[model samples]
Target chain A: MTRRVVITGMGVVAPNGVGLSAFETAVRAGESGVRFIQELADRNFACQLGAVPPLEASHLQVLTTLERKTLEASGIIYGLLAAVEAWSNAGLDVPGNEEDPDWESGCIFGSGIAGAEVMRDATYLIDEGRVKRLGSGAVSQVMASGISAYLGGRFGLGNRVSSNASACATGTESLLLAAEHIRSGAATRMICGACDSGGPYAWGGFDAMRVTNRRSNEAPEAASRPLSATAAGFVPGCGAGALVCEELESAIQRGATIHAEVLGGAINSGGQRKGGSMTAANKEGIVRCIRHAVENAGIHPREIDAISGHLTATLFDPIEIEQWSVALERSGSQFPYVNSLKSMVGHCLSASGAIEIIAAILQIKGEWLHGSLNCENLHPKIAECIDPERVPQTFRKHAVRTLAKSSFGFGDVNTCAILRRYDPE
Target chain B: MAPSRPDIIDRLHRIVEPYVEDEEALTSVDEDTNLLEDLSIDSMNLVDIILDVEEEFGIEIDDEAAEQMTTVGSAVDIIASRLAAAD
Candidate 1:
């Protein structure tokens, strides 16, 4: 029999908040971390607004100066901080310098363009004929798997240490993959997360593509209005979110506090076929993934009381809402309460799914839903599909059972993770 | 003129200080103080130390010279020699 998996710990370094408590408090209050980035303005970008984690000096206290010195990549630092928080929150002991690695644990942290800052710095050094002076940690900081490597070394993880990449779907994809690893009985636990480097260089291409919001730079918080009629585009954001997924048996043995059950998740690609393109997901592929996740989870789609959509406040929001209705075979008042964390944190790219998953878990555990901020003028198309009241306008007490959190990234990659409130029975 | 031997040792000590986690191992550091074995500085960090030394003194220590810098004394020797040669 496949081992059951559950999320035992969660951590987040989000644009609006850092750490679990801060994020929970911010989400509960409907606080938006979206803000105007002066650097984007100074850089002469069309999109002058962005969201980045407001990390303080004390946030780096978890790492020594030496450790801090090596983390040149912001994404790596974000991933490491979130992973550290998740690991500690799981109540697992970190292996000491001389201690043996925990063979049963591993990490699958991912990033999208995380090495931009490091590579930019390295390019300058190389141009100056200081190639050898690039230092040792430079490559690690610039490598795609750097985030997972740092996490593995810090925790002394002996099992597989890998990084997944699937654009905006990366975080949820990683979560699904890590959960599968535990269920396959190959590992007992895994740290699954993703991060992104949100800055001029990393976001410049999207700006060139005109996919980021350009109209609401002045009122930054009003920029990312998912499921709204006035959504110009997504407000680029970055940070990390992490969850510690453990086998139920191991968790029970350790008396760990189970947060949510991983009822299993599904990931698929549209193959850029039919209406799918390099930047958009095929509706059929999304529906299939959702149906498969629900079927594999041994639950009917109607039981999914809420949806944490991959709504990035773009043209895709309506399509995603409509697809959920088609796949779940439910609509109108029967539709689940739907919300977008991106409505507050903006589109965190690879980090969005993981961060939003944490938000969903918090909402599930507390039996309340955080408002999808800045969507006051709900898009008529979305309203046509689901009841307007289903998308809450503010923090409200609403109990939800199984929640379906879906993320569709560029290149037609899609993932739907089914998470349920852990029942003591 | 070549940099003073004592000055080179001091600068070398400071450069390696950040990489060394074993504070006590750093205190008794001498010419024979092994970088990897005693100070717990790995090979990857040794390259960083070498780079910092090069940046600090503005001299390029080639790969061969960098490889010989396994101990505090050898590292200082390489730096002193490079500085003298440049002068």
Candidate 2:
């Protein structure tokens, strides 16, 4: 028997806001987190604008001095803080002192490029013959699995503790992986999330590729213009998002608050074939992923009330809209309400999927659809595919029963998750 | 002015305070305090404490000596000897 999975708690350290309440309010108001970063400009980056979570030192007061001393990796710090919030939000004990780990709990946290800053520092120290000065924690911080390993140790989770990387789809893919673990009865609960570090080091390559927005560097607030006619390129962003997925029965047994039910999802790769390339997705593959997700969720496309899109404010925004329209066979007035978190938080890279999923769940629970920022002048092609009324320019209160959220990465990989309002039968 | 032996031990206590896992050990840390047993400083954190000492005292501690710094007194001895040699 397949076990049912539901989101019991969620936490977000987004560029727009550090916590769920703040983030939800910012998104509802269409607030932009993109800003002019002086460090990027000093480094001679083409696009000097980026979005970064405003993390203060007090946010990490729970860490020990040793942990703080060794904490050079920004991604790990963000991931851990977000995980703690989610754990507590689920009404779980913080700093649990159980003699043995809860063998049923696990984590599948991901980071696209972990510890680049620490690696760079280590390289410099080693080059200068100060190898002893390269602290022992350097290796742990630089490893791709650092975030998951740290979380596993922190929470005493004994189940499969692992990290996954698939560029931008990492966060969404992680949630789907956790759902499979529960569905197959491998684990009862799992903490899944993804994080990315901000700065010139993490975003230098994209800046060099000229894939970041350079047109609105002076007007940082309006830089990330997703699904708009003035859209240029994506603005690099960093932060973390976490969700606690628990078995439906397990959550109810523990009297946990159910945020939303994980109906089902699908993941696929285009193999970079046909029109797909290293940086672009195949339209057919996208459509297939969406259809498979809806089918797996045992819901018809017409049942989807809203869409949380991976619209990165690039030229591909219209293409993404078209793919969704074709996959659902809905266009013009028939199209579902669609919004992009990237419009406010910029492109959070690996963290985008989970962060956007948090926003989607919040909207579903609150019975409202947040507006898509900077899309007032919608792209002509996107307008041709969906009616302007379907894309709200401001927040609207409407009951949404089911929501579909998707994330597509640079390597032609796609993941779509179907979420439904929990109506216990 | 060069720090005396007692001064070095006191300073080491402050430096080691951060990495100590046991609160009681932190309160009564002295020359005989076993870094591993009393403070519960793992090998990874030991390396960081050693690095901190090196930076604080402006001395070079090779890997061989760093491995032998298992107790608070042992660390103080190494730092004092290195300081004397420099003088």
Candidate 3:
């Protein structure tokens, strides 16, 4: 029999809030994290409004003063903060250097813009003929696996400590893969998460592409209007989110408080074909991914109590909604309740999936759904696909037993995860 | 070299400030202080310290000389000798 994977703890360094409790409170209250970025405006970015974690360098107390000074990669900072919080929140002690490595533990933390700024700095140094001053940590800072490597060493994890990047789908994919590793007996505990640098350098390309909303620079809080008629484009955002997935048996034996269970999920790509491209998703691929996820979870589509969609405030929001309706074989009034965290936090790129998952788990645990900020005045297409009541515009108390979450990334990659409230049988 | 060993050591003190683990130990550091054992600086960081010293002095310490810089006194001797040769 396969082992079951349950989330014992979670941590979020999200645009809206930095810690679990703060994030939960902010999410439930529907507080917006999107704001006007002066730096972006100075850089002449079309989209000056963005969502970034309201954090200062002083808040990162986990690193030594020297290490923090040497660290130039923001992804590592965000990822480290969230991962450390998740590890401690799981009641796992941070292993001292003298202790043996935790061979049963591992991590799969991910990042999209890990070392962009550091590399830019390196280039400037090289241009100035000061390559010798690049320092020893420069390579580590610029490495793609920097976040996972730093986390692996910090926690002394010996098993499968690796990183993955599949565009924005990275966060949800990491969770699914982490659960699989435990279910396959490769690990007893795994920390899975994703982060984005959220610096101007990281958001510059998206703004250049005009995929981010620029019209709402004055109305920052209303910028990310997911599924709304007045929706522009997604507002670029960045941060980190993490979850500690432990074996169900081990968690029970250790008496760890179980938050939720991972009921398996599916990850797939659209092959960039049939209307799928660098920026758009193929509808058939999304439908297939969800149907497979439900089948993998050993549950029927009708059992999904709610959905957390990859509904960035863009033209694709309605498409994602209709795709979900098609995947679950449910329509109109029969559609399950749905919400998108992007409505408040903007599209956090790679971190969005993990942040959304944490919000979903919170919903299941708290028995309430946060309002989808700015989802009012639903687009005519979205209104036709799902019942207006299914999309909540304000926070409400409700029962969320099995919530399904899906994330479609830049390359038409998609991952749908099924989460259930932990129930001791 | 015109600059004395004490001058080099003073400069070295500033360079090693960020790499060493024990600020207390570094505060009382002498020529005999071992970078690894006394200052608790990781050996890998010694490579970085060497780079910084090169940048500060505008002189490259060969690998052979770099390997011998285990203690503050030894580093001073090598860097001092390099300065003398350059002069």
Candidate 4:
């Protein structure tokens, strides 16, 4: 028998807020985290604005001396911090004198570019013939699997510790993979999340692609205007998000505080076929992915109470809205409430799916849908697909039974997960 | 000028300060104080400490010698010998 999966704990190191409570509060208040970065301006980038987690010196207190001295990777730092918060929030004890690791607990933390900052530093050191000064931990810090490796060692988890990379779909895909692991009894619990580096090294490529909003350098907060007619492009963002997915029975036995049930999900790629390209999704592929996720979740399309879309404040926002409308076979007043965390925190790249998942779960747990920020002038096309009322402009207290969250990535990959309010039988 | 044994040990203490969890334990650390047990410095961290020592004293200690540095005294001895060899 397939075991049911549930979220027992969640943690986020977001641009808007460092912890879960702060993140929820910021999102609920429609607070924007995007800011004009002076470093980007100094580098003469087209997009001088980005969202970065405001990590204070206090945030580094948890790191051991070795970790603090040698760790230069921001993504790993963020990922590890978020993982620790999630682990503690789950009420799991840190292995002190145990000879063996927790075989039942695993980690699947994902990253797009794990250690760009470290790599840049290493490259400079190598060029200067200071290669020997690179330090022993430098390689680990730059490795793509660094986040998972560090987390696995820190938590003493012996099961399936791995990292997945699928651009923006990574975080959502990690959760789906964790749920599958739990359902198949390979592991009783899994720590799933993703992180992305901020600043020029990571965002330079996006800026060069001219895909980031460059017009809002002066008014940083208003830059990420998803679903708006004046929406320019996605604001680059960085940070990490994590969730602990445990077997429902194990969680209940441990007396863990259950948050939401992971009602199945679907992951698919457009294969860059038909109208799909390296960056854009094929319309049919997205619709199929969403429908399959809802079907696999054992829920009808109309039962979806809300949608946390992959609306990255790009021109594709309306197209995403239309796809959701077609996939669920509901539109206008019948359409569910839809929102995008990117409107506040910007697109966090690999970390977006995981951070947004936390936002979605919060909405379900609180029974309130936080409005998408800066979308007051809703795109005409999107307005035609869904009622303006469905696109709330402010936080609204409403009952959200089942919420569908979708993530689309650069490789034309798609992942959708359905989360339901846990009702113990 | 080559540093004295006590000077090297004092510098080693400063280098290992960040990795040492118990700040008080560092004060009483002697030749017998195990780097791993007493200072909570792991093998990976031992490597960093050794590298920093080499950079600070302008001497190179091979990996085998580094592995043998299990205690504060051993680290001091290794650095002293490496410095003498350089001289």
Q: What is the C-alpha RMSD of each candidate to the true structure, in Å?
A: 1.4, 1.2, 2.4, 2.1
TM of chain B vs. native, candidate 3:
0.95
lDDT by residue (tens digit), candidate 1, A64-149: 77977777788888888998999989999988988899999999989987767888889999999978768888888888898998
Q: Which prediction has the highest DockQ against the true structure?
A: 2
Q: Model 2 TM-score?
A: 0.98
Query: What CAPRI grade goes to candidate 4?
Result: medium
After TM-score superposition, the amount by which residue A354's alpha carbon in candidate 2 deviates from its true location, in angstroms, is 0.8
Query: lDDT for each of the candidates?
Result: 0.91, 0.90, 0.90, 0.91
- Chain B TM-score against the true chain B, each candidate: 0.93, 0.91, 0.95, 0.91
Each candidate: fraction of true contacts kept?
0.85, 0.92, 0.69, 0.85
**Tens digits of per-residue lDDT for model 4 on A318-395?**
999999999999999999999999999999999999999999999999999998889899999998888998988899
Clashing pairs in 3: none
DockQ of the candidate models in sequence: 0.80, 0.81, 0.57, 0.66
TM-score of chain A for the candidates in order shown: 0.99, 0.98, 0.98, 0.99
Give the better candidate number (1 or 4) by TM-score.
1
lDDT, candidate 2, A1-425, per-residue tens: 66899999898999989888888889888888899999999999999999999887887786666678678888888888888888888877544654788789999999897677888888999999977778788888889899999989888898999998999999999999999898999999999989988888999999988889998878998889889999999999999999999999999999999999999999999889999999999889999999999999999999999999999999999999999999999999999999898989999999999899999999999999988888889999999999989997889999999999999998999999999999898
Using TM-score, rank the candidates from best to worst.
Answer: 2, 1, 4, 3
Which tens-of-lDDT digit does each residue in A1-425 have in candidate 3? Answer: 87889999898999999989989999999999998899989999888998889987666887876777688887778888888888888999766778889999999988788777888889999999978668788888878788899889888998999888888999999999999999999899999989888768888888888888989889999999998999999998888999999999999998999999999899998889999998899889999999999999999999999999999989998999989989999989999999999988899998889889999999999999989988779999989888999999999999999999998898889999999999887
Which portions of model 3 miss their true places by more than 4 Å? B1-14, B22-28, B51-68, B78-87
Residue pairs with backbone overlap in model 1: none
